[model samples]
Target chain A: MIKHKALLTLFLSLFAVSGLFAAKPVPPAKKAAPPAPAVITGLTAVDMPYDAGNAAILKWAVNPADAADTFYVVYVSSLEAGGWLEADRFVSSAKTGKDVELPFWAWDGSSLEHAVKVELNNTYGDTLPGSVFQFKVAAEKNKQVIAESMPVSVTPVGNWFRLDRMNNLVLLITIIVIFFWAVSHAKRKGLFIRRIAGLDAIDEAIGRATEMGKPIFYVPGIGSMSSISTIASAFILGEVSKKVAQYDSQIKVPHYDPVVMTVCKEVVKQSYMEAGRPDSYREDINQFVSADQFSYAASVDGMISREKPAACFYMGYFMAESLLLAEVGATSGAIQIAGTDVEHQLPFFFTACDYTLIGEELYAAGAYLSREPMLVSALKVQDFGKLFVMISVFFGMICVVLGAKFGWSAFVSSVLNLFQNF
Target chain B: MKLIKKQIPLAIVFITGVLTLISYYVPHKVSVDYIETMNKWENIVVAFAFLLGLISLFFSHYHKITRKADGWGYSIFVFIGFLAMVVPSYTSHGKQMVDGMLTPLGWSYKYIYTALSGTMFAVLAFYIVSTAYRSFRIKSAQAFVLFVAAFILILGKVPLGQIIWDYALGWTGQGVSAVIEWIMQVPAVAGKRGIMIGISIGAIVTSLKIIFGIEKQYMGKD
Candidate 1:
């Protein structure tokens, strides 16, 4: 009885994998066989990395030669759910032709790798957390399943960390770590930020203003409180107001924002207090003009013409009003020192102003002026970061040259691809 | 007072800032909703700020008029202008934006504010010409180069420039337009990109500083 049971088990096992064990006889050549649909060469499902689970990347190679109007019903089979299941995923796109809902279109047919991410959903349209999911893509033609993809599985998972964006995160952490490290080290050693010429000219400009007894006109940009440029301007304002307090030079700050006015008052007052001349600080020196841009420009122009301020500081964010203020200052023969993050406007400031800090130099102004160890370290780290970028740029240039001149473009591209965030 | 001055504001900034930072990485529902809430709060604060701004302006102008200080005569005009803008809005019930031309407030905005604003913008055109003349002067080698570039740009834009180039070159190569395109697409773009990269890095570092509370100069203290 045991031998008979064993024989039956062997027979069932052999029957289960009969195709693999023994080939079927070629019956009547091709006449008896029905015409099968186009073959799906490769069926692959990879876990869609860096996603919030419930999705699996399904890749397949389809015979473009036998392209016809047929819907490819895509599904994922996972044992976690009962058996085979359908999903409502993010990358399901349907555009006319086959309604396969391809995530992307193939520009080239033969060389195309059709990769789609199938999202698994429950009965109630909600994302199912990643499980061992296998892809089963079928070509349905005329209400019948004609061709089916080979059994291949890809389990969608929610990665706690995005491996693709690891490079960027690492670089950022490195920069911050280096910056703080430099800050702490410099704090001990005593940091020194190199003198910025534009900032250096501030003292001379203020002295001229004091000697002439002319008020110094300052425009803290048109932007509201959220702008970094405006914030940088405020930091610089603290420094400038201190100098104004020292020389007893009148400083006029016409504001574009009311909130900025409040902030500037505090900053100016702080500066005066720090300078030990708190009596010189006045609220009238910093007041909000009209919020209207052109009106503000007109008023500032009028003030510049009438008051004839000996020096003008057009710091922070600026727009079309940049050239207007700088030009009037130039014509009035006031020493203008302008620093802003706006690059396009830099040319205008450069032409019309006595000195202009280009782009990042505006951010570096506080450090340069304060020469505080903490701020100086930031500038130093920025310089170091710039050096790293410059080195990368140098290599990038060489790679481009070699890629263009020689046929070693693939290796260069591969290297470039590796450095990308994704 | 301590809470308002230090604790409460800092707490708000920290909580809101950290949430916003997290939202960039996690594209989940909760983060998105929280960000939306923060945006709503921002709008409300700005609205209140605008209201406060109006009051501040009134007080400042009032002081100037009452004191009869330097350029005090200008204060009366400001009051007159304020009334001119406000009275119409009052009549229009703050529906000036969508109110028809028949409404006095809308009419004032259309006829007066719009006209003045347009004129101001128009004046910038003349200023640009004057400034360009000063900027593109051929004094030094640098100035000479700038002058040449300016000449080419001006020539490339106008029809006369293309005509001159076409006549001179005789179809042997591209017209002034091609040279202009090359200059803009290559050298100009290169310089712009460099400046942009520097600005982006500065912005990133500054933002990190602000986020980490290392830089708090804007908070009205050291």
Candidate 2:
């Protein structure tokens, strides 16, 4: 009975200890699904600016606290399809607010390029031109979407006009109007234009050729009529050929292209006729040279060495052969006058040629030589356009300096924005 | 006859020029499509004009040969070369293989034409030296300035400049190169940009003149 009592006592003590320490195993705490991400706020869509049309812009703001480091995927759905397709995706960690353009049109021949990286600022491209598109943004975390933005809708249309380029359009119209006015003004009378020594020396060179009884050489360059330099050179050639005809001096023109050769032949002939010396218009004056670059330069150099022309005219679009021709002329001691719209070759011509017309000076030669009000007016308008650019740059620079000096950050930024938009 | 000579070309120029201007600002599908079509047409036209150039070449050489022109000997070589290449071209179309290699025409182009062109380009090296000698002569204030700039530019291009600056002049590293860079980047670029602005304005004026028919010398009527 005493042993039984002792066992009972031990069992009672064990039960008391169990009551103090033992417990039921708690079920594993359910992993709480990430709290639904805050909805995208202030989502709106508008037509994209300054493009050939069929584009939309979507803008939205995300509470930085809600979607701080989540990857957000943007989905676009057309109204007819009624199903969302992935258009672009971005990570909210890179940006909290967004202004995105939806590319909605494509040209027939050109393929549009699109970028989807969140950090890369890019355009939306390759959407159909005439469709309404709906866009939604979804925030993703840990391989599960936690939040979604309400869908925004927009219809892209081909605008007849681009409003963002309005400033440029106005500039164009103003220039045109000024050109017309100047043309009319000059038609009534004459205008004062600066005399270019390179152009004026053309007459002197022709006179020297006449005195020497030697031929004058003209290189019409390698480019064809499609090149502006070639056409302008041809015009100047016409004017100079007229003077040459009047002086009864022979002029040799070697061509590099067939169409340019044909055009030049006619121009020389017409100039001869206009100068009342049609019989003097020799067909051989403008001869066809090899289309090969170095070959033509060598041929011309050979001619220069053999004939020893008194005057040489290198005009139009020249290339690697520019220095070769000019150097040959220098050795021959020919009165070389070079004119071209090519900037890279200008230094070479300037060095070797006695007279060099640099860049726009070549374009201005025709206007100066012809002195027709129509051409002269173009010159006047060109000066005016330069004046506009100069003024704009000057005012912008002043604003920048003043803004920096006085610490007017707002004024500085506004001016900078204006310049950028322009 | 009047339409062909003047009106048609002018109308085409005006319409196409205005359309191109419009396309720059407006990205409409019709405008884009028109531009693409025109670009293709331009390429086609250029290709056809190549034939015209070849025909003219034949006549030019023929006329010279018949007349026993001063360079008549060279004319024969040109004809021979032209025919030699043309015959092989027609036979091979530049793709036919010969001896497990490129065709004879391709071989001629690669070995003969390319080598000759490269040789011609290499000759410029000697020409530049001679030209530089004549050009660097200090005759005037402007020329003196140009000569100095040219010297600096030449010095900066080679490592000898750095060696001379560091050893002889007791200067630090990149001394000559830094000055040259500043000159090229600041003064040279500024001058170049000014010239570019002038060129752009001139191009605009000339293009406008052509579109409006004010510049007709190119049309062979002036």
Candidate 3:
């Protein structure tokens, strides 16, 4: 009986402990959702100007409070009912109209408006030109949609003219007018071009080669024929070939571009014909070297060292290989005349070459060598263009300074914008 | 023959040139498509032109070998190099990687071609030093000015030179680097801009002359 009483007391104590640890019922806390963000206003979609009818620009006014951690997601749909595709997304503060690169004349570029360019021909196949499309934007914060914009419809059409590039067009037209005027003036009065020492030395170099009974190597450079420098080099080559033929000297042209070699064959042939030495003309004169830059330089360097050509003419576009070729020719004791528009390589040529033609001088070498009225006239046009640029820069600077001093912001901006590439 | 050789080419040049100029200012799809097509054609033509280069290389090297010209042995190596790259490229179907590993052609390019190219490029460093030595010989007034400018430029760029400059001319607030920056920004930029402007004008006028057929050097003599 005593043991039974002790066990009953222990059981009662355990039940009391269990009752103390059990979970108790509590009132459900009042949980409320955060307030919804303000809807974006003035939502509009328009065709992107100066593009190929494949993109639409969506714009809207954003609330100032939604600038941080707020994203604007753009959706595009061909049909208004369904098939909405997420086109692009960006932070609310990004890509304002003021960030658009369009000129002030073409676009207002207001700071209050947000802009997004949506390409229709994206991964989703909505690339039909002249097709109407619907666009809508949604504002989201913390991965939850806070507000949505009304769907706006737009039709992207290809524009014929780029209004933003009007400044460029005007400049081009002015250049064309000046070119014609200079041409007519040149033909009538005969333009005067300054003497270029490098070109004047061409005949002497060829003569030296002839006297020494050694060939003259003309490197047309590694540039393709489409390059302006190569075209200019070809002109100089023609004149040089004529002189070489007249002097009855051998000329070897090692080429890096095959098309240039083919064109050069005709040029050298024509020069020979003009010099009344077509019999002396050889197709082997223009040989193809390796297309690889270093390999080409190495081959030419080897040729210079072996043949020890009395004169070497390095013309056209060159890269790092300029110094290698010039130095080898210098070591071979060849009178080297190098011409290129590559400014960085000019120092190397100036150091290693006997005569170096600087930037515009290389361009002018052909006209200076040939003394043709028409070609010389082009040089005159270039001079006038430079003069116009100088005057404009000086006048623009003065006007800008005065405008800034007098608080003429509009005038100053107009003056500055006139000089901008756009 | 004259009509085919000269007239058609000139006509094509004029049409293409004008169209290209107009395309720059036109935003129409047609203009964009035309440019894209022309670029594609140019790339195709350039690829075909490579064959011409290969043929020319083969014939020239063959001629040199047959003549037993000086360094004729080098010409044989050209064939070896060409075949080394071309045969593997053909076998690999022009794929540089196979099963996440470099193909034989890729190996040749990485090992032989790249190594050779780098070696050749490395030689430029020596040449630069030599060229600088020759250039800064103080032969004339212009040379002296160039030497002074190069001295400051080099001195301002290195740490030891900067320390020396600070020690020598620390009293002035303006450092040698500031002077160098001014020189680069003011004179260097001004000269570069001037050259750029001239080059642009020259390129434009030359293009016009070519389109008008006044510059026929590219087409051979008149």
Candidate with top TM-score is 3
Q: For residues B149-192, could you state the per-residue lDDT of candidate 3 as single tens digits?
A: 88989999999999999998888888998999998999888987
True contacts kept of each: 0.36, 0.56, 0.72
- The superposed Cα distance between candidate 1 and the true structure at residue A105, in angstroms, equals 22
Order of candidate numbers by lDDT, starting with the best: 3, 2, 1
What DockQ class does candidate 3 belong to?
medium
TM-score winner between candidates 1 and 2: 2
Candidate 2 at A143: error in angstroms? 9.7
Candidate 3's C-alpha runs over 4 A off are A1-37, A62-69, A78-94, A121-130
Q: In DockQ, how does model 1 score against the reference complex? A: 0.36
**Residue range A188-279, candidate 1, lDDT tens digits:** 89765667899999999999999999999988989877888888888889889989999999999988887788888888888898898988
* lDDT of candidate 2 over A5-121, digit per residue (tens): 999999999999898788767899999987564666766665555454555655666455555556777777767657777766666654322222221121111112122222101
TM-score of chain A of each: 0.69, 0.71, 0.85
DockQ of each: 0.36, 0.45, 0.51
Q: Write the per-residue lDDT of candidate 2 for residues B147-191, one digit (tens) a residue.
A: 989888887788987677667655444578788889999989988
Best by lDDT: 3
Candidate 2 differs from the real structure by a C-alpha RMSD in angstroms, to one decimal, of: 9.6
**Candidate 3's residue-wise lDDT over A1-422, tens digit each?**
99999999999999998888785867799789665455789999999998878888888885787748889889988753457889988888898987777777887877788988888888356446337899889988888988888899998899999888899899999998988888788789888787889889998899999999999999999899888889899989999999999999999999998888888888999999999999999878998888899999988998899999999999999999999999989889999999988888888998999899876777777888888888899888888889999999999989989998999986887777777886
